[model samples]
Target: MEEQVNVPQIFATDPKLFRFLTKVIHDQGLTPGVEWKVCEGSSRGDNFIAVIKQVVHVAEGGTALNLLVKSAPRNAARRDAFGIREQFLNEIDVYEKAIPRLKSLVGFDLPVADLYGATSSHGEETILLADLKELGFCMADRRQGLSKEQCAAVLRALAQLHAASFALREGSPEEFAALAESVREMFWTQPRRHAFEPFMRNANKETLRLIREYYGSADCDNEYSRAFRQISDLGYDFLANIVTKVPENKKVLLHGDCWTNNLLFKTNDDGFVSAKLLDFQLARISAPMIDLIFFLFTSTKPKNVGNYLEEFLRVYYEEFERRLKTAGFTAAKLYPESELLADWIACVPYGLVVAGILAPALYCPDECLPNLESVKENSREAFVNEYGKVMRANTPESKEHLGQLVKLCVEREWLRILN
Candidate 1:
């Protein structure tokens, strides 16, 4: 039997927490005497990541270091607060298991802080990690989505990470399974299913309503219209398909949550490439294509839809094929590259619904928060003007491609609304 992993134990208890952080720094060749300061302008919540400023006490001079002090939200009134303690602990497992493996691929690609277990003076669990600001880093603002350069860097990093896993599984199945087991629940659990159900229902309703208002009765017979009306029902099916229908043997690690906000970017002085990545909290074992489609559709404008996406997937497959060959893993016949376009079509609708629901939340200003009243006033024309390509709606190619994607999901028996 595979080792029975205990999630809770992975987190350090109160008394042992400080020592863990100190030990992590020491192991990394930094001195033990360190100063800690919380990062400014961070959001607070139950189980939210807290940032801290740290300085290692050096013999010659203590240089400043920015550290992320990750903590679980301890809010009592929150209904969605179950198992938060386990969540933080799970994050530790993710960092410990994936980071080292990923390091070889990206060569310090991500601007994440060093994570060492730590506890507070009053007996609370904490994690000490790197600070983005200390490295002169800030995440790409979710308002504008990723710039072309940011997309390229992110895609390259993803390709490398995916390649590393392909290499591992191909070379040493035992080792790969062992690591995956440690963090498997990070992605697969349906703990929030109850809360998510209502959210998804509302999303589906809104999608159809929007479609009706925008297109009028003329295109009601269109496949795209039919698909939009049934997106929400498909979400549950998707969840079931990905989580249950797909056999365990076929699964690979996924980012689980691959939205742009979850990603961070580190850029050079002239705003060119440096490194980027963040929010490993949702890392899990799943199909890799989900991550790619999720990022491209939700985080990019329609103008960026085709060629760049094609190139990115090509690069991923190229890397995947190379690694598989190196490890003597010849499953090329099983997962043929020729099937990519078909898979892409199948996956695009999933991206569409996700992107539609998320576009408001990710891009909205605080003043335009998604209150019922605001939503009532927010017309489809405004939404399209803000994010969609007006030209895309008129173009024959865009319509056909977009319509085909929508049609497939509808035929697959997806529900009318999507969350």
Candidate 2:
């Protein structure tokens, strides 16, 4: 057996549990001697993640094998400040249920390492998973905006995902609803609703500053500022109403947080090839159209957005309807294609509230360029230049998308002055 090096402090403090965890690994069919190593995950405030790596040797004595060992924070006492219960644990439960259902349906191209369940002598839960890089996957580049072709790829993928979830719900209503109810602690809690209020207040101020900076000094009553204000005021209302507004008796698993960062891309030796969905931390059962609308507004580039918008809607409707039929619902009774966009448009304010945050806040000072420096320059003009990227309407693609969106808003009498 290879001697283990000094593992990180995360494992160092719990030597006895480490030994027990390794023993469970041996029970999985490896020999008695497997070395454990430490792995790291990005920090989320006070709570942190660590992985245990165990090198396994077959008892029959041929080749050595590598295995990933993981545990949620074993410290039950450590759960107070970070809101870990509502976020992290909720994700694990949802993924455990959803992954099996998803695999049984479409069988995704994205890689999933192994999932092994473990428990401490005290009954705490630990999970061992296969690492993605070992299966040849890496995170996607955020700097490269989603290309038109890439947009098509993700749209098709979303269709399958939406279809599968809808089918599952329709085919096994009680079981699906039970699973959704199981994870409702994260989505339907009062905390999340409260969390949004403060976040929205801050977001509203940031968006207004962004809009004024992008568009020139028009009176506060001018069309541009008026439009900005209209949406900003209604932001929370739109978010709160999505569940009520969606088609009655229809709910699908929604990737509640469907931004570019959460949707990872996979590439081959050639270039960008496919995308993988990630961060199920906020996944929930909501309107299917919510995911589609979120992806279009928040992730796609302003310019290419217009051309692809209709195409995407058409694709999603066809797929959703097809899957509904496969799962045994009539087209007329289930999800109607014509109603999809109307449903989508009704959800536009929610989209704008989400899109308004991406450009300025999403990218770090490093990945997003030109404007990154502008924000630091701290001049009124620089701020305007940075904000105008979203507000002033730069490319023909953007103008097309925004124009349609504005027209929709006008029809709804939303942000009414923008009309």
Candidate 3:
């Protein structure tokens, strides 16, 4: 799947993909009277879950429209192990149902990519979206993480989204509950745990190993070891229950995966970095702290995190409060600043677990990324375990990512309860 796949080669391998792309174009009223071809849209490490390609269209006088189309996985092993179809359906459901409803409820436009159409027909699942690159946006270098300005931009965007979820929840409880029902918990569900358990256990073990290596004595029944062990021991139900069993007062739909790559940025006319959210595959109903903590750990410069962690909290809270206030709800009564901070402290373990999962995708350069589809292995567990081994090869970038987060957590006493 990582090989150089030309248009003809792609169509030859997956014949029906072309038809689906064409149908999306026709239905979306895009590239009227133009020929189109599928071409590479992103590099290998930029995206992993979907087969992404650009539907490049050109007319007689060179009028062009370049849109991005994401389809299902091509490999059966990857498809089944990752439950690509289920995630695709979840993502499509968010775009088709949740986004529009949220927009209407919030009375403002969210910063998501403009989706043209989505479909899950026969053997093909695809979503057509206007390309952000075509609109003067690009990804920051993952190794460096987002700058303070970029992070503030992302946090502000996240606040608006979390606020919108709160608005929907308060204004229409039944409707909000219905929307929550449609979002399938893609990551930590029972049926898919068989496939994800090996990955999770191995990932947790690797992180614990790194913790011991970094601090040299963080093992031996210490908090660091206990934290990762708790996650690995509890596994699926532990993680799933944190999300699916949320209290009514603590509920808000989370952008469950908010790693660096899932966000795109451009400097607006106001000369500030602004972000557009991407990837709803992991969208689920949960508290806002999960999203906030995950992004802060995995996507911000670790140095900035230790120094400006409270600043980040303030930025998000002020915006969240503003949005809630506008909707005739008092943020103090609904979710006070003290409670948000306390909840955020408690959610650090969740952040740590998810940040380990994000490390490979966040820090692995295109040159270092492996093609999971082509890996030779006996079963999903073996493949996932091997993948963890490869990803945790004592690479400086990833080790620093883990080390800095752990250090910050320790300094803040966020991991103290693990003991």
Candidate 4:
């Protein structure tokens, strides 16, 4: 592993993990004598699964280099609580196996941060990735929400990733099967799902409480309470099944979690140039609409949705079709418009269920978030009791957006919440 004494104190904290990071620079054609330093990669609450560290290095004569290192939590209690290891391994598998095959199909068109290296075994996991910020890409404000223009960019970027999945699968079924089999579903497994069940149910309860405090207060009629009561009855497994058990030939390796924060945008003098997808921790092979619904409702500004939801869908469709045909693949026939709509309708239920957790955290203030970098500081089990209480209070943005999403889903008939 490059002599341990030469390693920076920040990285030297974890020798095995450092071994993986050092190999990354070497593979990139760097000399052993290169200078390197480490610093906090992201702000608090911005990342949870791993402690993100940015390693900046300067070669003897060439340009300086900055890269991100995602190191797994070493504490077993913190790591296993929410299946953090499985999620990290799933992401590692995607970078090592799936992304390369798909990138070969789409060339350099796929808009994910460059993958340098990934390693995980016997509970120590780490992945080295390109820092998108170094490439001038920045995330949108999760609280203020994304504008129509920004949303269009993300949809187009998502379209490219989704399209590549189609080209690979249709062009070579065996390769696609191998790729799919390698990626583990982050949620909905036996022990993990069971562990997550109570947390999810409580998040739902918190949603109802927030709704009562926000929307319910403004309404003359008790719509929020009545709606979620029906939601509470539908049960958890039903929603999980709709997301996990897609009828064959209808799923893709989704970014799995596509909120505003994970979708980064790059702009030039003229305008927005590109968007890069980030954080593959929850990456899973699931229905395409799950990603769509997750991004639109949970991550978007409440004002941009409701009656205007179809505009974003149109944006996704046009770009996706253009990409598929350009790749020498068939047009809309690959995913018939009718079937796409059906799949979308089926996915809304899963979206509603996930919003309970994603929505609250979407706009939570920094102080409200649990300190994830320190193991004992905020263990998942300890935080589970009060998932959305970020610093003991819910932000208005989270509550308002979540409530609006429910109303919009009902209005569009995308979901059925009996009242």
Candidate 5:
């Protein structure tokens, strides 16, 4: 006879969900006495995540298993409001379909959280996963970028991810196509575009204001100024079309949103030993540089970029090539270093746009954080209003970071590449 366990209210309120989660545990070969607790700092956006601690009592006392449960928010209105239901579905596809296929490649280890089970209906979704924290994973500070070693580790992980996609596409085209077709381009969805246009316009205006203040009208004829002017004037159109364009040859499955907040790192006495990518809600099929440039600009310090940008690029390229060859493909024939650099240079303007818009928010004081709820209610107006407040509250450090970014673009001749 087995003992009956009382599930806590955190997961017990819904009997169906409780039974589903219990089955998840049992399928993992765990006994049924389970306890649930809300994960600290896990309730955000459209999901609520909890940790399940299962203790099985037997003749030899007991054993324990800890798992994570992420589900749609209980509030029906809020869950329905943001119009991000498809994004959740896309994330589920990544974990349930994409990761498994990628992991099948020889010698490839997917640097993402392990999934136990996933379920969705209508606009609601739930995903149960192995708790990475239980495996000694911790997030890097969002305010501070990764150290050199940490950056290298992340780049290596990204290389494996990208290479695995290439291998899948070559070895199992049908399977790869099926998974890729399921990924939705959430960032470019009509509602998101409506919200993004006004935000881009405001960001362009602010970026130009800063540039003029720093370089003055006399310098407008210079190459850097001319490029900036052209890009800024195009504004929303440039952002909408060019930034989202997929490259013909160098395309791969992109992490899409690779900002610091979505990455977790594990460190030991030597330094960062491993990294895990998270938050696949924005995953898409696009140029690999889209992920590379986005991660470089948003998650790294200006000084770090200045010192090691090329080195970092090389690391990613080398590792990508290594994995490709290991999977029995010719990297040079498929994705040479020259092609990769050319793709990266062509994407610099996109990086500038993202950095410009994200800087103010990324650096805004805690008190000045935008009311995301209000933004969801009225995206265009609320975003523009919040953009003003963010720019007003921007710190000198952030301003300098933006300035350095532009300077680097000029020095690297990224503008020249565009022309």
Candidate 6:
């Protein structure tokens, strides 16, 4: 005899949502007595994510299913104020449309979450997905950073992702164009960009202060300092004008926010076996180096990046070329290693700026996170105030991370490009 499990109270609270879940379960040919319990997710994500453990009773036995439910904040004002509705739509588009196209074009499943269903209306949206944890996939610790093998696995996965886009562009140009047109650059949108400008300016100020404090006044005007100062002075304008600009020639669908938290790794006794990308809300058509640099600077440890930078680039490029060739395209004619390296060099400042803004939030304790409720009530002022609190809370770690990043940039003569 099978032990009976009671329905969780969490699922009982929303009859409408429960009905949707019931339908989804039924559509999969599972028996109906579905019960769910809430699980934990990221604190910093714009939307609310609830990992629900669902138990379904069939004729022979009862099986447990873990489903990830992501929903827009209930407050409509907050959704509009933060432009979260648009972000949610972008993610929905990627999962519902882009992923299917990629699978058909590339003849394989891309490394992303399997979506069960999604709903969007006006300011509200909800998505249900298979919880990756059920498949032994877990997030790498953002604070600790990734090991070399883990980093390699991520690069390889990213290579495959990028190659799929290239193949799509070659095989079905119109379809690829339509897919690109469907998604917008989250950071470049007017409302979100306005909200982000103040944070960028503040981050620049804090970064400059850290540089001077660490390097001393005597060294403050050195090559690195000069380059940092130039960008800091330019601040948000630099971001708007240069960093976010898309090169016409080498655009690909980017994972936009390619940090550690956005990635999940499954490891076995030997090592990291596979990885999956999450958070497509920021996905956009852009230079592939944007994703590459974002991942390199914000996710991996400074030591690993310093030690294996060239090797990592090689792994990504080689895998990218191999995939492109497998997809019946000449890798050399389409995207050579030389061009890739050049694009990376050109995008170093973009990586630095992103790391500066992301480090504080990534390092801050959960208790130190901004009160989004306040932002919902008073968007701009509340957000800026909370941003300051977060930045102050994580200053020490942010400084250390920024210092290493700046040092790496200077050593590689990446600062010379500023001249």
Find the candidate with the highest lDDT and give its number: 3
Error of 5 at 111 (Å): 0.5
Backbone clash total, candidate 2 = 5
TM-score of each: 0.69, 0.71, 0.88, 0.91, 0.84, 0.89
Q: How many steric overlaps are in each model, in order?
A: 23, 5, 0, 2, 0, 0
Give the per-residue lDDT digits (tens) of candidate 3, residues 1-419: 53222345566777677666556655655444446566787776677678788777664466666778888866566676567888899999999998899888777788898887888873488898888888898888887888999999899889989888888888899999999899887666777677666777778877777666665554455555555566567666766676566778878888888878788999989897888899999898888888888899899767888888889889999989998887777788877888877887777777888877777667665566756656776465654554554465555577677777777787777765565
List the candidate 1 regions with Cα displacement exceeding 4 Å.
1-37, 41-60, 101-114, 118-125, 184-192, 214-225, 247-250, 268-275, 318-336, 368-419
Query: Candidate 5, residue 173: CA error in Å?
Result: 2.3
Model 6 pairs whose backbones collide? none
Q: Least lDDT summed over 10 consecutive residues: which range in candidate 4? A: 383-392
Off by over 4 Å in 5: 1-3, 12-16, 41-61, 74-77, 189-192, 209-229, 240-244, 370-393, 417-419
Give the range where candidate 2 is weakest over 10 consecutive residues by summed lDDT. Answer: 42-51
Alpha-carbon runs more than 4 Å astray in model 4? 1-5, 217-221, 374-380, 383-392, 416-419
Positional deviation of residue 301's Cα in model 1 after best superposition, in angstroms = 1.0
* lDDT values for all models: 0.53, 0.55, 0.77, 0.74, 0.70, 0.74
- Check candidate 3 and list the clashing pairs: none
Model 3 collision count: 0
Against the true structure, whose TM-score is highest?
A: 4
Error of 5 at 20 (Å): 3.2
lDDT of 6 by residue, 1-419 (tens): 95343455665665666667667766777665644556545555322322223333342256665677777666655555566778889989999998888878776678898998887765447788888877899887677778888888888888888989988888888898999899778775565677677767787777777666656653356555567777677556556544457655566788888888788899887764688998888898887888888898888777788889899999999989988888788778777888877788887877888887788766777677766655544454455465466677655666678777888888877666677
Give the clash total for candidate 5. 0
Looking at model 4, residue 167 earns an lDDT score of 84
Q: Residue pairs in steric clash, candidate 2?
A: 114-130, 213-384, 214-388, 303-397, 303-398
Q: Worst ten-residue run, lDDT, model 6? A: 45-54
Error of 6 at 282 (Å): 0.5
